[model samples]
Each structure stands twice: as C-alpha cells, then as structure tokens.
Target chain A: MTDRISNKKNITLSIIAIIVMLAAIYVLDIVIKPTSSWSNLMTCLEKGTIYALVAVSMNLLNGFTGLFSLGQAGFMLIGAYAYAIFAIAPEDRATVYQYYEGGGLIHFSLPHMLQDMMGGADAFGGTIGYYLGIILLMIFAGLITAVIAFLIGIPVLRLKSDYLAIATLGFAEIIRSFFQWEGLGPVTNGSNVLRKFASYDSSIFPVLVAGICVAFIVLLINSSYGRAFKSIRDDEIAAEAMGVNLFKHKELSFVISSFFAGVGGALLAMFQNNINAAPFTSNMTYEILLIVVIGGIGSITGSIIGAYLFVCCSEWWLRGLDAGEFLGIEADFMSPGFRKVVFAVVIMCIVLFYSRGIMGTNEFSWSGLFNFFKTLPKRIAAVPGKIKAKFSNKKHKKHTENVKEAQ
Target chain B: MEFIAKWLPYILAGISVGGQFALIAIGYTMVYGILRLINFAHGDMFMIAGLVMVYMATVLPLWVSVILVLIITVVLGCTIERVAYRPLRSAPRMSIMISAIGVSYFLQNMALYITGGLTRTYPTIDWLQKNITIMGASTKMVTIITPVLTIVLVIALVFLIKRTKIGMAMRAVSRDFDTSALMGIDINRVIAVTFIIGSFLAAVGSILYFSNYTGIMPTSGSMPGLKAFVAAVFGGIGSIPGAVVGAFVIGICENIIKGLGLTTFSDAFTFVLLIVILMVKPTGLFGEKNIDKV
Candidate 1:
C-alpha cells in the first residue's frame, strides 16, 4: 500500500513537472520570433533538437538493442522525401519540379484533401492547416519508415555487428540511388530539389516535439520492455534464454527507432525548406552516430546535451574558427575547412579520453541536482585551499624530495 | 550476336572494375580478419593513394610517382593502425569503430581543405590509355590489365599467406588473439604487417581504379570504398578468396544493370544483391559458421 502510494506520488510529481516545463517553454516560444542575430542561435537550437531526437532514435537501437544499424540516414531520407511530397502545396509542384518534364503525381496536399472531405474547407488554408498537414505528414513518414524497417529488419537484423553495419550502410546507399533513379522522376522528381514546405515560424515547435519524444523514449527505456532490450544488448542468447523473444524485441526496437528517425528527418526537411537526396548520405548518418557516441550511448540526457554541444560547436563556436580567427587573432591562410579539422581533432580526443561519453548511461534528475547543490558550497570553499596547497607543494618540492631521500 | 556485341564491352568494363574492387576488398577482408574491426579509414587511405599519385605525377615520372604512391600509402596505413587503432584495441568495439570513422572524416576533410574542393584530373599514362579490341569489342587497355593484375596479385597474396612464416603467424592471430599472444606472437607486429599488406593492395587498386575513372575528389573513394566493403560482406567477411569473388560479382552485376538502361539503379542494385545474398545465407558465401560458447 505504501509502495503504491509512493508510485502515485512519483507519477503526480512527474506529471506536474512535465506540465510546468511545457508551460514555460510555450510562453518562451510565444516570446521569441525569428528575429535576426539571436535567431540564428534559436535556429541552431531547433536543429539541435531534431538532431537530439535522431540521436535518441539511434541510441534506442545501438545503445539499447545492440543493433549497430547505419540505416538512420536512409530512414531519414525516406521520411524527409515523404514529408516533402505529402506536405508540398498543390500549386507549388510545378515550380518545384520545373526541370522535370512531368510534375509529381501528388497534385493536392494531404491535409487540404482531408479538410475538404471533412467539410471544413474554410478552416484548411491557414496556420491550422499547416499544423495539421505537418503532423499528419510526419506521422505518415514515421509509419512508412517503420514499415521499411520491418521489411529490412527481417533479413539484415540476423547478421552480426560489423556485417549488420555494412548491410545497413548499403541500405542507405541504395535509398540514395533509388531516389536518384530517373524512372521515379514523376514521383521523386529524379534528384531535383523539392522545396516550399510548411515550416516552424519559431524554434519552440521542434523543441516541444523533440522534448516530448525523448521523454517518451526515456519512459520506454525505464519500462520492462526496455529492460528486455537492455538484456538483448547485454547478450542475445541470454535474452532468448530468458524468454525475451530476441528477434521480436529487436524488430520492435528497430521499428520504433526508425519511426522517430523519420519524424526527425521530416523536421529536418522543414528546417532546410528544401529536400534533396544529396544531403541524406552516409555522412549524415555518421554525424548523428558521432553525436550518440559523444552523448553517453545509453543516456537520453547525454544525447540531448551532446546534440546541443555538437550543433553549437559546428554552427556557432566553430564559425569563427573557420573564418581564420582564433580568440581575437587572425590568420591569412585560414581556409573554410579549418574548423572541421579542429572539430574532428576534438572528437578524436573525446573518443580517446572519455570513451563512455559525457553521461556514461547516467540521467539527470531532481535528486541529483539537489545533491549537487548541497555539495556546491563545500566544493567552492575547497577550491582556493586546494590551489594554494598545489602551489606550495610544487614550490617546496626540493624539501619534500630531501625528506623522501632521508626516509 | 547483336546482344553479345552490345554487352561485350560492358562485360570487359565490369571485369576491369571488378579486378580493382577485388584488390580493395582484399584489404578489407585481411584487416577485418585480423583486427575484427571495420577499418573505415581504409577507403580514405585508398583515396589518399590516388591523391598522392595525382600530386606526384604532376612533378615526377609516372613510374616514380607510382612507386612513391605505394610507399606513402603503406606508411599512412601503418601510422593509422598504430595511432588510431592500436590504443583502442582493448576498448569496446564501438569505440574503435568510432575512431576509424573519425580518421575517415579527418582524412576526407583534410583533403577537402588542401584541394579546396577541386576535382583533380587523374594523370593518365600513355600506354594504359590505349584502346584494344578483344573479340570484336573495343575496351581500354587498363580494363584488360585490371583483372589480370588482380589475379596475379591475388595469387602472390595467397602464396604469401600460405607459404610464409609471417603468414602462419597471421593465420594464428586471426584464429585467436589471446592464444596467439600466449604463444609469443607479436600482436603489434602482426597487425602492422596486416595493415601494410592491406595498404599496399589498396594503393595498387587505386592506381588501376583511377586509370579508368575520370578524376579524383575527396569524395571519390567513398563510393568505391562503400561498394568494395559491400563486396567484402557479400563474399563473406573475413574470407580473402570470398572477397575477391564477391567483388567480381558486384562489379559485373552493377555494370550489366547499368547496361540495361537503368544506370541509376546500379548502385542501389548492389545493396539489393547484398540483401538477397544475406537473406539466402546470412553468414555470406564463404564466411565461417559462427560458433558460440556459453
């Protein structure tokens, strides 16, 4: 009875916490427009949110289910294209597919069509339409990707680590080439850029979506099914022995992960406002995987943090580095790619030094924060004394050496 | 007769390309066989090998540049193995894989920075450029040379792997890392040797590969590299001869598909082939049966 009561309290606390966070974010979202200068930061944050969602999706498969799939980019590509096609306005198809002889087969937008069928045609052309369209498109994208994952998973998931990695990598390549195929030009526009989609006016939209998705993933991770996924990660044979249904759980995890990856990809298409097969290459998958590694693989909070850091590093912090200026200094030969060189070096260092990444499968919680605050004053007080002691010890090293020699 | 006439040149092109792929796939299989790590940087090494040829041929004779390319790539391969992979030997598989990927990105970006994203024309050799008619079909001389060279190298490699003491050590190491170490096999030396051999083969492959291709870019190695890795898996990962066979099959299949007026589907078709092969035989054509211990 007491345990049940505590569980009830925990649930109520979590609900209240989530509501407060959401409310605060909603107000903040209203406050910020897509203004200049700081708007770029907001853009970076928005991009980071989508990346975090993708990273969490990867973490669900790689970190939880022990499936090293490089197919995230492929699924993302599908999702982005699906969203681009489904959400593209009826009138814009001509211009979007200008170079191609035949425009896409999709003449009417899905949401608008649905709206007309519902007899709410007047309510369909405004921001509400955009919202409904994007949500529906993203859902369709997720379902499509999940279905693809299901089919691909049947054959590819049975392969072991590096083999699986190679297979998925091939899958991504196949997806790229398929989209680039000329025969599919009527529908896919044959590698031509697809543009003019409904996008977020403010960064808060993706922030809310990604935040809720990640929280949901975290809840899933903490559940019994998640434990089964973890068990599979620990050892597949043992998981099977324990009646975990290895293939079923792996497929489920793969489908779920691909669903979010697709959603994230849809968000990516919206953010870019132009969809092309060129951008959805293995490199994109590699970058997201790098984010997952930089974040603790099994930790959702780490993925969120890592996504922010990666976005900030590449978009904001590394910009000046790329411009040939280093901390108030300028160089003549500073090429555009110096920032990436430095960034790659830093990533290598992190991979070497903190292989477990920033989180190490640990999550950030209120209790942890409370404990940190409790120790804050003591740590602050000890810093000066510790520095002084270090200085003194270095200065008195000769006497200490003499003492050691005497001993 | 008309179908044969039309398809014969493509077949020749396929065999030629197939040869280079076999060489590259051999590198993948050998490294994977020993290290049990997917050396993602291997493709970049192949790219760098091509780049070295481009840079050197502009300044030196073709033969000297070819020799220098081989040397530079060998040194590079060894250095990468020692620096990027050696320390992570005992770390988790994922960490090593990430390190390999980091090395790959670093190399590609550095090339990008140096070349300024320019696509450098691969220096052509006079003799290798000759168009020769074989069985009423004309094809580039390099195309005919590629498969022959691949076979010769494979034979020599098989000899090195089977008839030599170092090859014995290599086999032992590949069989069991700890047991070989306990038996006094120098793990580091064996790994370095594997990398050297792999890099050497990739260098030669790059030379033959770029001969047929138009130009070299930072991204050039990625496509061929991806295809070669796929070939390695399709042949069965860790099996050398299997890699060679897989490469030829992929090369020929893609070429034939390209010939079918579905040129765009060729790349996608390779993966489709991979999926089909994997479904039919998950371990690949020659991959050893997996044995698990409780």
Candidate 2:
C-alpha cells in the first residue's frame, strides 16, 4: 500500500514537472517578440528545439536501448518530404510550379476533413486550422517514418552494434543518394523541395510542436515500457533472461525513435522553408551523435541542453572567427571552416576529459536547481580558482583515471 | 560474345579499382584481426597520407615525396594506436569502436579546417600519369602499378605475419590479450608495430588511389572508408586474405553496375550487397563461426 502511494506521488510529480516546462516554453514563446534581427535567433531556437526532439529520440535507441544507429537522418528525410507533400498550399504549389511542376499530379486527393482542417485548400485560409493541419502533417510524417523503421529494423537490428552502425550509416547514405536521383524527383522534389514549402513567420509553432513531441517521449520513457528499455540498455542478456522480449522492445524503441526523428525533420523543413540532401548528410548524424555524447547519453534533458549549447557555441564560434578583424589581424587568419575545426577540438577535449558528458546521466531536478543556486556564490567568488581547477589538476586526474579504468 | 567484348573494358577498370581497394582492405582486416575494433579512422589516415604525398611532392622530388609519405603514414598510424587506442585496450570493444569513430571525425574535420575543404590536386608527375594500353583498353600506368604493388605488398605482409617474431606476438595478442602479455611479449611495442604496418599499407594504397583519381578532398575518406569497412566485414572482418577477396568483389560489382548504365545506384549497390551477405552469413564468407560465449 505504501509503495503504491509513492508510485502515485512520483507519477503526479513528473506530470507537474512536464506541465511546468510546457508552460515556461509557452511564456517564452509569447515574451520573445519578433524583430527583424532577432528573428534568426528565434528561428535558431525553434530549429534547436526540433534537433533536441530528434536527439532525445535518438537517445532512446542509442542511449537507452544501446543500439547505435545512423538512420535518424533517413527517417527525418522521410518525414520532411511527407509533411511537405501533405501540407503545402495548392496556390503556393502553383507559384513554385516551375520547380515542382509535377507535384500537383502526384498528391492524392486529401480527405474532406483534412481539406476542411486546412481551411478549404486555399493558401493561408483559417490561421488556427492551417496550424492544426501542419501539426497533423508532422504526426503523419512520423507515422510514415515509423513504418519504414519497423520494416528496416527487423532484419538489420539483428546485427551487432558495430555492424549495425555501419549498416545504418550506409542506409542513410543510400537514402540521400536516392533523394538525389533525378528519376525520384517527381515525388521527392529531389533537391528543390525546400524552396517549395511556406515559411512560418512565427517561431512559436515549431517550438510548441517540438516541445510536445519531446514531452510525449519523456512520458513514454518514464512509463513501465521505458523501464524495460532501460533494462535492455543496462544489459540485454540479463533483460532477456528476466522475461523481457529483447527483439520486441528493441524494435519498439527503434520505431518510436525514428518516428520522432521524422517529426523533427518535418519541423526542420518547416523552419528553413527549404532543405536539401546536402544538410542531411552523414555529418548531420555525427553532429546529432555529438550532441548525445556531449549532453549525456540516456538523458533526455541532457540532450536538450546539449543541443542548445552546441548550436549556440557553433554560431558564436563562427562569429568569433571574424572578431580577429577587431584585433587588427586582417590576414584572413581564420577561415569559415575553422568553426568545424574548433568544434572537433572541443569534442576531443570533452571525450577525453568529461566522457560522461555535461550532465552525466543526471536530469534537471529540484535538488540540482537548489545546488545551482547554492554553488553560485562560491563559483562567482573564486572564478579563477574554478577555471584553474577545471584545467590543470582535477581534469587531468579525471582523464587519466578514466583512461586507466577503460583499459 | 558481344556482351563480353563490350564489358571487357569495364571489367578491367573494375579489377584495377578492386586491386586498390584490396590494398586498403588488408589494413582493416589486419587491425580487426589483432584487435576486434574496426579502426573507423583508417580511411582518413589514407586521405592524410595522400595529402602528405601532395605536400612533399610540392617541395621534394617525386621518389623522395613517395618515400616520405610512406614513412610519415606509418608513424602516424603508430601514434594513433599509442594515443587513442592503447588506453582503451581493455575497455569494451564497443567503447574502443566509438573512440575510433571519434578519432576518425576528429581527423577529417581537422583536415577540413586545415585544407579549407577544397580539393587538393596532385602535381602531375610525368611517369605516374603516363597511360598504357592493354588488350585494346586504355589504362593509366598507375593502374598497372597499383595491382603489381598490391600483390607484392600482400605477399610481403603474409610472409611477415607467418614468419616474424612480432607477427607471432600479434597473433598471440589477437587470440588472447592478457595471456600474450603474461608470455612476456612487449604488447605495446607489438601493437605499435601493427599500426605502423597497417598505416604503411594504407599510405601505399592512398598514393595509387589519388594518383589515378587525380584529386583529394577533406571528405574523400568517408566513402572509401565505408566501402573498405564493408569489404572487411564481407571477408570475415579478422581474416586478411578474406578482406582482399571482398574488396575485389565489391569493386568489380560496383563497376559492373556502373557499366550496365546504373551509375547513380553504384554506391547503394555496395550496402545492398553487405546487407544481403550479412543476412545470409552473419560471420562473413571466411569468418570463424563462434558460439556466443556469454
């Protein structure tokens, strides 16, 4: 009776936490007024939210299920194209006719309810309705990707982790190459589909969409099924012995992860108003993996935090490259590619020193919040001491200890 | 007869490329054989070696550039083992594999940053670029040289593994790491030598590859690396001669697909082949069928 009561309390607390997070996001969406310059920043945040969703979903497989997959981008591609085909306005499609001349012919007739929901098929018809349509399209995209993931996972997931990584990486490449083919352009719009979609002027829609998807996934993870997933991750053999269906759980997690990745892709496409095979390359997979690794594998909140830091750091680092101009070193010392170089260096340092990543499997909790406030005084008082500790003594000892432990 | 006549040139080209792949595949197989890690960064090492050769040729004479590239690649290979891999020698195989990927990404991105992501062209060495005709098919002198060199190196590698003291150490380490260490082998030195030999082979393959292709880019390693990895897996990852055979098969199959008017699908063909092979024989063509120990 006591255990049951505690379990109930735990569920209630988690629900309250999720509601609070959603409320905060909603407030932020309203507070951050759109300006011409700040619009890009807002969009970046929106895009970051989408990436956070994808990263979290990927963590389900990579972090929780212990399955190393590179097919996230492929799933995203599927979702982006599906959402585009389903949601683009008919008149807007005509304007983009030159690029997508055959698009109209390929789209099947929409269901009456969907047409009504989309405000009678006209461009910019009921604002709320169109918004709803976009959400539906994103979900549809996720479902389609989930189906594909299910089909692919059955045979491929049987392979061991390393081979699985190689196989999935190859699968992503194949998807990209397929999208690049001119013959498949009728449905895919090939490389030109990005230009055909309507851009969302407000960043709120994407943020809300991505946030909801992430929350749903988090809820799922905290459920009994989620414990099964964690069990598989901790030890597959043991999990199997304990009556957990290994193949079933793995497939479920894979499909769910791929589904969210697809939704994230659709949201990404909506934000950019255009996407190409170029951005969704193998590098994208690596970048997502970096986010997972840098944030803390198996932690959803960590994935979110890591995505924000990574995107912001990359932007700031890129901007700082030109800051050499202010210092009078006008020799073009830092090229644009210097950002990736710096990013790689940072990743190496993090992998070497802080292999558990920033959050180290810890989530945002009340106690953590209290600790942050408590430590603020000491952190501010001895900034130099803290910096020195991070670099010279503690970090080196930690890295060496990790290396020894690994060996 | 007509099909054979029309396909002969494509077949020859395929074989030439296959020979080049075979050279790189040996590196992957040997490393996997010794340590059950895939060495994801092998392709990037090849790219770096090509860059080194290009840089050296700019300053030094052709033969000297070639020799220096080989030496530098071997040293770099040994350094990678010592720094990135040696520490993770006792970690889970998956962790080492992940580190290998991290190292791979680090090398490629570092190259990207340094080289500005531009395609670097090799200086036209008069002899290397010379063309030759065989059975009415036009081919580069490098293509012919690649096969000959590949065969010689494979023979040499096989003999070294069979006869050398270090080779025995490598075999022992592969069979059981702690046991070999107990036998008083200088495990670190042997591992370094293994990496050096692997890197040396990769360097040779890179030179021939870039010479024939005429260009090198920061991202050039990814596709070749992936294909070579697949070849390693196809041949029973830890088997040396098996990797060679797998490389030739992949090269020839890819070429045949291109020759049959599916140039766009050639890259996909390799993965499709891997998936099919994996489904049919998970341990690979020549892999030892081991039961799950756990």
Candidate 3:
C-alpha cells in the first residue's frame, strides 16, 4: 500500500514538474524577443528539442536493440520532404517551386485545405483546424518514412554489425542522390530548397511534440518488448534461445525508431522553415550518433540532456569561440572554424576517456535527486577533514624518511 | 572507330581514377585486414596530403614537396593510430569506429580552419599536365602514368607482404590478433607499419589524383574516399587483389554512368553495386567467410 501511494506521489510530482517547465518555456518565449542576445537560448531549446527526439530514437536502435543502423539522415530526409511537400501553402507553391512550373504534382496544402473547410483562417474553428491539420501532416510524414523503412529493412536487416552500418549508410547516399536527380525535379524540387511551408509561430509546438514522443518511447522501453530488445542487444543468440523473435523485434525497433526520427525531421523542417536534401548527409547521422554516445547510449534521459548540451554548446556557447572574443579573452587564432575544431577535440576526449558518457545507461529519478541533495551538505562538510588527513599523512611520511636516513 | 573514339576518354579516365582509388582501397583493405576497422579518417588523411602538397609546392621544389607530403601524411596516420585508436584496443568495436569518426570530424574542421573555407588551387606539375594521346583520345600524361605507377606500387607491396618478416607478422595478426601476440609478434609495431604503408600509398594517390583536378577543397576527399571504401568492400574487404579489382570495376562503371549522361547517379551507382554485392555475396568475391561463435 505504501509503495502504491509513493508511486502515485511520484506521478503527481512528475506532472507538476512538466507543467512548470512548459510554463517557463512559454514565459521565456514571450519575454525574450528574437533580437535579444538571450534569444540564443530559445533557438537552442527549439533545435535541442528536435535533436533530442532524433537522438532518443537512435538510442532505441543503437543502444537498446544493438542495431547500429546509420540511416537516420535518410529517414529524416524523407520526413522533411514529406512534411514540406504536403504542408506548403497552395498560393506559395509557385514561389517556392520556381523551377518546377508550379509544382506539377502535390498541389494541395493540408493546413489550407482544412482551414478552408472550417470557414477560413479568421475564425476560431479555422485556427483549430489548421493546427489539427499540421498534427496530421506530421504523422503523415512519419508514416511515409516508416513505410519506406519497412521496405528497406526487408533486404538490409540481415547483415550484421558494421556491414549493416555501411549498408544503411549506402542506402542514405542512394536516397540523397535519388532526391537530387533531375527527373524527379517536379516533386522533390531537384536538389533545390523547399520553403514557404506551414510552420509554428510559437516554440511550444516542438516542445510539446517532442515531450509526447519521448514519453511514448519511455513507456515502450519499460515494456516487455523493450526487455526483449535489450536481451538481443546483450546477446542475440541468447535472446533467440529465450524465445525472443530476433528478426521481428529488430524490425519493430527499426521501424518505430525510424518513425520517430521521421517526426523529428518534420519538426526540424518546421524549425528551420526550409528544407534541403544536401545537408542531410552522413555527417548529420554522425552528429546524432555522437549525441547518443554522449548521452549514455541506453538512457533516454541522458540523450535528452546530451542533445540540449550539444545544441546549446555548438549553437550558442561556442559562437563566441568562433567570433574571437570568448569570455573577454581575444586571440588571433580564434577564427570561424576554430569553435568546431575545439568542439571535435572535446568530443574525442569524451569518446576516449569518458566512454560511459553523462548518464552511463542510467535513467533519472526523483528519489535519486532527493537523496543526492540530502547528502550534499554532509559531503561538503567532510571535505576539509579529508584534506587535513591527506596533508598530515604526507608530512608523516617525510618525517619517517628523514629518521630512517639518520639511522 | 567512332564508337571507340567516343568511349575512349571515359574509359581512360575510369582506368586512371580507378588506379588512384586502388591505391586508397589498398590502404583501407590492409588496415581492415589487421584491425577490423573502417578507418573513416583515411579519406581525410588523403585530403590533407593534397593540401600539404599544395602549400609545400609553393615554397619548395615539386619533388621535395611530394616527399615531404608523404612523410607528413605517414606521421599523421601513425599519430592518429597511437592517440585515437591505441587506447581503445580493449574497448568494443563500435567505440573505436566512433573514435575514427571523431578523428575525421577533427581533421575536416582543422582543414576548414586552416584554409578559411577557401578552395585551394592544386599546383600543376609540368610533366603530369602535358597532354598525351592514346588511341586518338588525348588526355593528361598523369592519366597514363597513374596506372603504371599504381601497378608498380602494388607489385612492391605484394612482394613485401608475401616475402618480408613484418608482412608475415601482419598476416598472422590479421588471422588471429591475440594468438599473434601470444606468438611474440609486436602487435603495436605491426599495426604502425600497416598505417605507414597505407598513408604512404594514400599520399602517392593524392599526388596522382590532385594532378588531374584543378582545385582541392576540404570535402574533396570524401567522395573518392567513400568510393574507394566501396571498392575495398566490393573486392572483399581484407583482400588486396580483391580491393584493386573492385576499385577498377567501380571506377569504370561510375565513369561509364557519367558518360551516359546520368551524372547524378554516378555516385549512387557505386553504392548500388555495393548493396547488390553485399546481398549476393556477403563474404565478397575474395573475402574469407567469418563464422559467429556462441
């Protein structure tokens, strides 16, 4: 009975914390205008939310399932393209697809179409319809990518380890080239940027979407299927021996992880307000993979923390390093690409020395936090005594050495 | 005659580029044979070789710059092995691969910072730049010289690997890493020698490659690097002759696709071929089959 009550209390506390975080984001979004120096935090929050989703999805496959697939960028490309292609305002099609002669295919806009059915954009009904349409559109994007992943998985999933990584990487490159092919110019815009798509006016859209997706992922990870996935990661043959359908579980994880990655891509496209297939290279996949590694591969919360830290550090904190005036210390060697160089070196150090990363396959818990805080004062109070003991021990060792020499 | 004349340039370019790729692929195959690593930074190393040659040629004589480039590249490759890869010898394979990716990222960023994102013009070697005619298809002398140079190097490499004590050590290490160590082979020394040979060949490949191109960018190495890796895999990774053959095939096919006006698919074609090969024969044409143990 006490355990049940404690569990209820924990749930309530978590809900409260989430509400508080959301409220804080809303307040910050209203207070800090885009032009302010502090706006970097907002940009970080937006990009970080998107990256968090992608990183966690990747963690699902690479960490939980032990499938080292490197096709996240390709899935993201499909998602971004699907979202952008379908969400473009019908009137803005000519302007966005200037090379395609009014986008020979995909003429309808999901939001605009839904808005029209609900008495146009000025009414409350239309406003609700627009958001609803966008929600459906994002899901549609994820579905499209999921379907493609299903097809790709059939042939590619049989390969082991590094071969799978390389094969998926190859598929990503193939998808990139296909998207850039001129014959598919009308639909994909032939390597040109797709823009003027429907996007969120407020940052809450991403935070909410990412929060829900992460919650679902967390729930999945706690389920029996997640345990099966973990078993496979630990030992595939052993997993098979224990009656876990290895291929089925692997495929399920791949599809679901890819589904979330696709949504993340759509969100990314929304955040950027434009999309291009060019930047969706193997490098992007590597960046996300690095994020997962930094976050402690098997921990979802770690991925979230790592994603935010990575985005904020690279996009905001490291900006000063690039501009040559970080912390009021200016140096001639600090140039445009110096920040990335420094960032890469730091990542190398992390990979080499701190391989367990920030969380080390552990999840965050409220009880753990409370216990840490409770012990903080006691730990701090013991610091000076420990230091004195160390110093006296060194002195005693020196005196003993002198006495021995005299003897 | 018209058909032959029309197709000659593409085939010639293919053979030349194939030779260049062959050099790079040999590096990849040899390293993978011993270490079971993809060595993602090998491509970046090739790019650095090009950049080093460009900068050195401006201040030093051409021959001196070439030699210096080779030495610098060897040093860089060995240093990377020592610093980035050696410490993680006991770690999982994935961790080492991630470290390699990290190294690649570092190298690319370093190049970007040094070049200030500018495309450097490749210094033209007079001998290489001279036009030569082969069967009514005129091309740079480098086109002809690349294959000859590549064959000579491969012969020497094969001879060394088949005859020398270090080569035997390498073969033993690749065959069984722990067992070779138990047999008194200096594992670190063998690995370092592999990097030396790989980097030296890559430097040579860079010289021949950049001689054909008018400019070199920070990203110039990635495409060729990937294609060469694909070649290595296609020829059955860890097999030298297989890598060479695979490089030639992919090079010819890619150029042929370009010749056919499907220019965009030229890069994609290599991957398509890779997937097909991987699906049809996971062990590749010359690769020994690996059995998973419980």
Per-model TM values vs. the true structure: 0.92, 0.89, 0.96
Clashing pairs in 1: none
**Interface RMSD over true interface Cα atoms for each candidate:** 1.2, 1.5, 0.8
Give the candidate number with the greatest lDDT. Answer: 3
Output the number of the DockQ-best candidate.
3
Model 3: lDDT to the true structure: 0.92
Q: Which one wins by TM-score: 1 or 3? A: 3
Between candidates 2 and 3, which one is better according to DockQ? 3
Tens-digit lDDT track of model 1 for A122-220: 553455665776788889998999899898888888887877898899888888888888788878888888888666666668887887788888888
DockQ, per-model, please?
Answer: 0.62, 0.60, 0.76
C-alpha lDDT (0 to 100) for residue B90 of candidate 2: 78
Model number with the top TM-score: 3
Candidate 3 lDDT over B136-222, as tens digits, reads 999999999988999899999999999999999999999999999999999999999999999999999999999999899888887
**Model 1: per-residue lDDT, tens digit, B7-30?**
998888888888999999999989
Write model 3 residue lDDT over A1-407, tens digit each, in one string: 11223787889999999999999999999999999999999999999999999999999999999999999999999999989898998888888888887564779999889988997989999988888889999999999999999988988888888878888888888889998898998888888999999888888889999999999999999999999999999999999999999889999999999999999999999999999999898889989998988998899989999999999999999998999999999998999999989999999999999999999999988877777677889889999999999999999999999999999
Interface RMSD, Å, model 2: 1.5
How far is B67's C-alpha from truth in model 1 (Å)? Answer: 1.7
Better of 2 and 3 by lDDT: 3
After the best TM-score superposition of candidate 3, give how far the Cα of residue A355 lies from its true spot, in angstroms: 0.2
